[model samples]
Target chain A: MTPTKTAPQNDLPEVYIDDILMTLKYFTDEHEVHLKIIDPQVCMNCESKPCVQFCPVGAYRTQDGGTVQIAFQSCVECGTCRVLCPNSNISWKLPRGGYGVAYKFG
Target chain B: MSTKEKLTFDVIVVGAGLAGSAAAAIAARNGLSVAMIERGQTPGSKNYFGGALYTHSLLEIYPDLWDRKPPLERPVTESGFWFLSKDGMVRATVQGGKMQNDPIDAYVALRAKFDAWWAEQAKKEGVFIIPKTVVVDFIREDEKVVGVITDRPDGEIYAPVVIICEGVNNLLTQKLGLAKHDLKAHASALAVKQLISMPAETINARFGLPSNEHGLAASVMGDVSMGLPGLGFLYTGVDSVSVGVGVTLEALTKAGIKPYELLQRYLNHPMIAPMIAGGRLMEYGAHIIPEGGWTTMPKLYTDGALVAGDAASMVNALHWEGTNMAIMAGKAAGETAVEAHQKRDFSAKSLSAYRARLDKTFVMTDLHQYRNLSHFLKSRPDFMNTYPAFLNDALGMFFSGFGKPKKQLYKDILRSLTDRRPLVKAAGDMIAFGRTIMGF
Candidate 1:
């Protein structure tokens, strides 16, 4: 439950998403080559960028040329970008068994 | 393994999450030649959860689960719920082992380790586990799904029946038009979580836990999501803690905050920061949960196919359980498929028994009871927002002990709350909340 409160002091937790992802790289069972780019025509000029708005990992983003870009490696397989895309444009599939994250402490 | 063999079985279970594993294991044990197709290299590699597992139903399937000595993190013997205000907090906690014969209701285990063990168990029971194979779509013949088409070369595998347990995002269900093609974001909650590294001694000192006892299962609200109906949870492992936040998808999108950023906000909250003061982050990930309860459920069964777990939307959101429901649902579906296999009938009529089985279990009963929960929160977002703030303020005022008159203190507290939301609205909200949760 997100609650409103006084501002925080910006004390950094010793954790970093980059470092966590790096550690996950060691446990990866296989190299990922499964994810496919969605039809660019549908994503081009897309302003709301629903995929960007809902992805928890910030994997999807609007790029310089009005094209949508996604970093599959950063995905923890949350599937939000796949499920909540307004146009249903994200053609998501399961990363090959053992190819994606082999979570050490899931 | 390549698809060079005749790839046919009595039943094919897709996606090796908890639900798929349960379905495959149960079906194979019941004398059905089951093929458990996993998109992961093994079970649990593609799965994630909130670090809690109710073992009652899982135990029902593998009565000797402990005999194998699976990689259980710790037997969860204590839990708490924290309602936080800016400076103060109110908490209610339960001691697990206190229930004399409850037999350890749940445990904390890492999914990657637990799932791999579970899939291995299924493989031992004669279930053909095809790891690293992705089931891209179903092969239907005359309106009956007879096989699955994977992404591999000649990846079509035929089966009389198929159990779809593809987690929350059931793309196969969507392709079959079982669920909506344009499902809304609000239908699920977006959960982002991290695993933090903390020494066992530090955990014991911090949570006041005995060396032998397991760690706490604590939940937090307020000041974690900027007044959004998001929740932060903390569950400890032997050497780590799993901390997470789950906000309604609609709320997160409307707030325009990245999930990681919100998670950082939770980590920085004055009340929350101290709990994990010296811990280092180890793992981070996110998932969409079926918190919409029964209301957002898709069709459970069709010709030659049945959906279990998140694919069937079987999560009891209020109770914070999906794995238990998945286990029970998969068990029921497995039993139903066994019946169908005996009769050689792969029709929806035969599979309706799966629904009947769920109806008799908490999976469906509790789901139906709280079918209106998502609606309630969507209508009145303040129960998680305004009420918490007011409650915190009231507690702070009443406990200040500044030598004010008791009667005046009580009056001031009432007046403060009523002034913010009015007595009439408060009364109405109470009634509404009662009706929504109590199922009036």
Candidate 2:
């Protein structure tokens, strides 16, 4: 079968920054956010990383020199990479309770 | 924490499946003290589906869920509809890899693990979750619901509002007269599923998976139903594959065909057998799905109480959408509860907002759009009969090279169409199908 190319229509709004800021205040203390933010260099650069393309939310983006950066706040906890990755480098877990995507329509 | 036998909540949600957990999480996050009750050993243990979690509605609740470690089996990159006859398949597929990028797209999930995680999220938001406790009935006061009566000793937990997110076995909803006592078998479907264990490498090779990506295949057997209104599905899980068939109880009973036999035949199909070859059955289970769509939706809200999820029969069969509707309805109910609490009025009038919200959401909108489909498909057996065979025969003939002239082959295919169904009737059926099932 020929590979089908389709546009990704499900991009998250840049306003996600605001939603994350609000959810952080409601569900967690600033200390937790600070602790999680300490690891800015967590992404180990891999040539064939599936997360860059497989993340349903488009949360992973490659920056200058191929460094992988994740917008941690927008993660929905779908656990796709945890099971898909052959290298098993992705540490997957649910967002801190009461904090991530609140699926209104699941 | 005070276990003083006295605690009140803004909302009491029963059943911690997709709907219940979503309701509790959304309500509590809005700053309402909520209580989620589950009867299962854990949430999701009792729930199952062809099991795709569509993100459109879930995105409203968890906008950033795609970025998080979601409880997803595979990011579905390919979706197709298959009309299968004895030896032919008519297929239509939209190969949009970009469609999976939407944070709110669908995800394959197992209810057992997913529900537990959802319940935990609700609890983290201070939503008191009482698991292993069954809500026996709604505590009605003066013809209005006030709280719930649970199986727990001294388990009369009172709340101003209650939302029922129970799955298809809606015992309480029926008891409360919210829904009819006995549903028409046509309004429901009995699905028997098997989880077949297979090696990951083999699965990837068979289904053509790219690392974590997955594929879904749904087909309708022309004669497998034995003239019943139903379909079959095969979804790829991480280590196991889920295969099943669901027939309407009315059809199954009328035909007297055992569901297991139908499933066995489906598995034995030439096209399906090779895919599941060498796989061992790890689990076998059956469940009921509300196929009633919009017509079967009960009076959704009452004084001080609301009904959400499958309890309301909010399933859209056209796109095989359920879990997202359940979660969306739960969120809407939660928001309504917040509104009612703020006004200090949990009357049916105040809770009617839940209905209004559903109308605006895809749950009700999509169901209403396909409202006539279930009945249409039932009335027209061609969907399960002539169409699949036509597809199969046409393809079989087109691929067959018996040295027949191309002109004669085209004529032969046209003759086959008229032989199975009159051209006029087929055209009419196609038009009706497009209008109803396709939501045109």
- What is candidate 2's lDDT per residue for B260-352, written digit by digit as tens? 556766777677789899998765555667888788888888887888887888887767888888988999889999899889988888899
Highest DockQ, which number? Answer: 1
Q: What's each prediction's TM-score? A: 0.91, 0.78
**TM-score value, chain A, candidate 1:** 0.68
Where does model 1 exceed 4 Å of error? A1-20, A26-44, A48-53, A86-89, B1-5, B96-101
TM-score of 1: 0.91
List ranges where model 2 is wrong by over 4 Å: A1-106, B1-7, B97-104, B221-224, B438-440
First chain TM-score for all predictions:
0.68, 0.56
Question: Which tens-of-lDDT digit does each residue in B215-309 have in candidate 1?
Answer: 67877776665667667788888888888888888777676666776787677777777879989888887788888768878888889999999
Residue B121 CA displacement from its true place in model 1, Å: 1.8
Q: Fnat per model, in the order given? A: 0.57, 0.00
Report the Cα lDDT for residue B245, model 1. 89
- How far residue B141's Cα lies from its native spot in candidate 1, in Å, is 2.0
Relative to the true structure, candidate 2 has a C-alpha RMSD (angstroms) of 18.5
Give the winner by lDDT.
1
